[model samples]
Target: MAGIYIHIPFCKQACHYCDFHFSTSLKYKDELLHALVKEIKLQKSYLDNETVETIYFGGGTPSVLEADAISLLINTITELHTVSSDAEITLEANPDDLDDAKVKALRRTDVNRFSIGIQSFFDEDLLWMNRAHRSRHAEASVKRVQDAGFENITADLIYGYPLLTDTKWKQNLDKIFELSIPHISSYSMTVEPQTALAAFINKKKQQPMNDQQSAEQFTVLMDAMADHGFDHYEISNFCKPGHYSKHNSNYWQGVKYLGIGPSAHSYNSEARQWNIANNAKYIQSIESGKLPAETETLTEENRLNEYIMTSIRTMWGLDLDKLNSIAKASASPLLIAAGQYFDSGWIKQQDNVLYLTPTGKLYADNIAAGLFF
Candidate 1:
């Protein structure tokens, strides 16, 4: 099955650590919406007639869109393609945007899931990250989503910020568990090169991220999730039984999806495309009846590397037999070389599936590289 991703490309304000394509100004909102609708029509056949099982409204801040605008966009897509009856329609919402009325309006639409960006439950961490919402709003957003009867929900949390001590980090996860959030995507904070946080660290105004603390916190995350009965399905994702995110799971499984709007990426089995990150350029190009995106044709080696990268990050480890079948010539030598890591306890094989052990996960990248052609 295929999926659809629509990027909103607008935020109330920029976060210090965010490098996503978005405009602080909403002056071009009307024009952008018009161009987006046109884009939906233009890319109608990109999915090759596969029924869309997930529709994800992501980036900038999808919750910032007016309810009418959201409804209009969903309606346009439904008219253009055959969406599945039980599609996992998700909207990435910010805490500040989830007022009672807005939440109610969203529930009435085709959107069946909510993914809230609540980076932390502490005010100090929120301030440090330059988030638009306070810690209180962070807690309230998920509550409102559940209160609205939306059982399919996901929330994002950040760990390992300089300001987040182990005690505070524990509290953050505890609070989420107390609230009974079904799905969580927790990431260790990193300094993206051009973000304000990176600049601050470069100037010595703010401390650089501590790799040791980050690793330690990640261990804490694993233990806590295990205690809570949350399945560690992917590297950074945890979910209750039967509540895994279908959209992201499809992505990991190499499902084809059409990405609409600026800075979005799409992939079919053989090729991938990424839209221009600039809003003005995207709109202008689409208006001129030209799609402004670069395409990459996947070579055999590229596909192999991608499979290794994604497969090892999940509970479902890499299938050696499947690999041998798909990329026959490259498999034997790689498997022979990987035996060292396997013998050293960094990698394990069971039922012909190869995966990282807990120690191996710390160096997943390096291990994957060693096994790569």
Candidate 2:
């Protein structure tokens, strides 16, 4: 199965810790929309004959688009590609934009899922992150989606911000459980380079993130999610049974997907391509009948490394057989090293499926890289 991702390149405001490609201005929005539709038609053959089972609208803030604009884009894509009858179409929305009217219009479209960015439910934490929505809007948007009869929903939450105490974090977790939300993608606060949060920390204007707190918060999240009967399907994603995100799950499972729009990346087994990150440049190039993207063919080493990194992070751990087949070498030494972690109760294996234990997840990245050929 294949997937399609459309990147919306505008946001109402910039979050302090966000590093995703986005522009704060909407001056070129109409041009960008036209470019996106044109790009979809131009790249219609990227996925070959595979049926697209998922279509995700991601990036800056997909919900910021007018309903008619979103409809036009979706319709344009449908005209160019073979969309599965039951495709999972998702839109990444900010809470502020998920108003009653917007949600109503969204329900009428092919968009079957909503991935809301409810970073935190606490007003204080919201302010610290410079998010544009309030705590009430976060809660209300979810209610509105449910009230509007959309069940396939996921909300993102952030923990371990300096302003979020254990008690407050628990409340956020409890709210999701209490609301019976089907899916959650939660993460610890991180200060990426070139982000406002990183600059604040460098200037000593804001307190730096505490690793210890992050670890504790992660543990708390694991316990709470498990207690609520959510599967730890991936490192950051948790969902009730049968509620995993089709688009993202396909991504982690190495399925080919075509990513359209500025700053988007598309992959089809052999190589990957990324569009220009600048909005204006993207529109101009697409208008000139060119896809304004760079391509990279994957080396065996690069592919193996990607497999190791992504596989180890999932519930279905790294596959030794797959590794041996790809590398054409015995992975005994790597298996032996992994066994040390297994002995320490950091990892476990059963039915040929290896996955990280709770303790190992804290060091997942380091562990996965070490097991690489």
Candidate 3:
């Protein structure tokens, strides 16, 4: 199965911690959307006729567009590609954008899931993050979506920020339980270089993120999610049974997908490609009958290393047989390197699968890097 990811590169306002490509101005919204549709048509054959199982509208905030605009894009995709009837179409939205009218409009379209960006349920945290929506708006938006019969929902929450105490973190998870949100994606805040958060910390205007606090809160999250019967499907994602994110799961499982729009990335089994990050240049190139993207063919080592990086972060762990199939010579070296982690109880090898223990998950990146081909 295959998937499609459309990046709507516009937001109402920039969040302090964000580094994703986006424009605060909506002056070029129409032109950019048209370019997106054109891009979709241009790259229709990327998936090699595999049925599209998921269509994700991720971005600066897909909710920034009207439902009709979203519907038009879905219609265009369905017309050009063979999509599954039960495809998971998800739209990432900000809380303030999902009013009654907007939700009603979205219901008329093919979208069946909503990944709301309600980073925190507290006004103080929201303000600190420079989010445009208030805490109340988040609650109201979830209620509105549920009232409108959209139950396939997930909300994002941030933890380990200087402002987020353990008590506050529990409250955030409690709020999700109270609302009966079926899926949750949570992350410990990290300071990416050049982001406003990083700048603030650099200037001593904001307290830096504490790794100890993040690790503690992550353990708290795992416990809370377990109590709520949410499956810890991935390092950062928890979902109800049968409600895992198909799009992202496909990504981890190495299913091919086509990414449309600026800064979007696409991968087939053979190669990976990414569109130019500049909105103006992306649109200009598309208008001139060109795709402003760079492509790289995956080497055997690249494929093996990528598999280790992504698979080790998921519940599925890493498949040694799959690794051997990709790079026979590299597998022994990886296994030899992984012996240190295995001896330390950070990773467990069962049959042919190498899975991380809870302790290893905190250092997932480091462990993966150590085992890289």
Candidate 4:
């Protein structure tokens, strides 16, 4: 019914296109961990005693920690919240960190899921992305985890960059299918401001991302996943039946969850809050028994827009009945707004549910934004 997301704010190196909060240096690592434990205890009531069905260790690179350290954090969560016995405890890791020894060590802990960051299967692309791991590490890491009896796994792949030819993209997809990894999370390359990729584009050092190329590759990705019998459960995620990431699915479904660590965000239906991004400041505030965070109370309009945005991205589509529940008759205006998309054959309705057609997915953001209150 609920989940917990813990952000481990340290990475071995920085990726060119990454904009997530992380530190290349592990200077505040030990102190940060201690403060994280304190924050967990302090925010125990955020979810109002709901059972935690997922505990995800995301960002900067959760696999950077030792097995014992990871176990300690899980143990802390168990003490504070009622975690489901079969809960999906996931660790987001880089391929280079998942050597045989590391995978074996992780198997001894509570982690039953692995979210591997295997951006590409080519050394040139890896170098271009400034990723810490190469093609060898990318393939070997997933196999090592599977070899260690970890079947609940998902690997990330990136496409739509200048160097990713159609053949190369297929090759990457083939490698994953060959590996028989049950779940995949793929994304198109985007140039976010303040990132190295953005800087490169600004200086004409690297080519900017191509929207047309991304659209073509995404179409390819969808077809390939469908051919392999993987469900396109959400826009960016695909999985064999029943292999979805419970934590992320919960997010799209609007379930309550507490976010721990710097730059983490939490939601409990009516309001949302996120901790400060500064490690030292977050640690200091937690140590002083104060939450270093900002909170937002959701208005009726805010809730409706959020629901439309998240729901439309999933296979479940947006429920007009549910939308009306948020604000009476809200779906009428939305349907009126969506008339153009309907005319374009981009959306269809059945039994009060509005589902996006395949073509509609290409402009999902635009469609969702247009229908927003």
Give the number of the best model, judged by TM-score: 4
Per-residue lDDT tens digits of candidate 2, residues 51-104? 999999999999999888888988987888788999999999999999989998
Q: Model 2: clashing residue pairs? A: none
* Runs with alpha carbons beyond 4 Å of true place in candidate 2: 325-329
Error of 1 at 70 (Å): 1.2
**Candidate 3 Cα errors over 4 Å, as ranges:** none
Clashes of each: 0, 0, 0, 0
* Candidate 4 accuracy as lDDT: 0.93
Single out the weakest 10-residue window by summed lDDT for candidate 1.
322-331
Per residue, candidate 1 scores C-alpha lDDT tens digits across 1-373 of 8999999999998999999889998887888898889999999989999999999999899988988999999999999999899999999999999999999999889889989999899888898999999988988888888899999988899998889999999999999999999899999898898999999999999998888998899999989999999999888899999999999988877889999999999999799999999999999999998899999999878877778888887889888776755556456777887888988898998887888887777677788888876
How much lDDT does candidate 2 score? Answer: 0.91
What are the models' TM-scores?
0.97, 0.97, 0.98, 0.99
- lDDT per residue for candidate 3 within 1-373, as digits (tens), equals 8999999999999899999999999989999999999999999889988999999999989999999999989999998889999999999999999988999999999999999999999999999999999999999999999999998999999999988999999999999999999999999898898799999999999998889999999999999999989998889999999999999999999999999999999999899999999999999999999999999999988999899999999988898889777767546788899999999999998898999998888898999999998
State how far residue 349 of model 4 sits from its true place (Å): 1.1
Provide the overall lDDT of each model, using Cα atoms, as 2-decimal numbers.
0.90, 0.91, 0.93, 0.93
TM-score of 3: 0.98
Candidates sorted by lDDT, best first: 3, 4, 2, 1
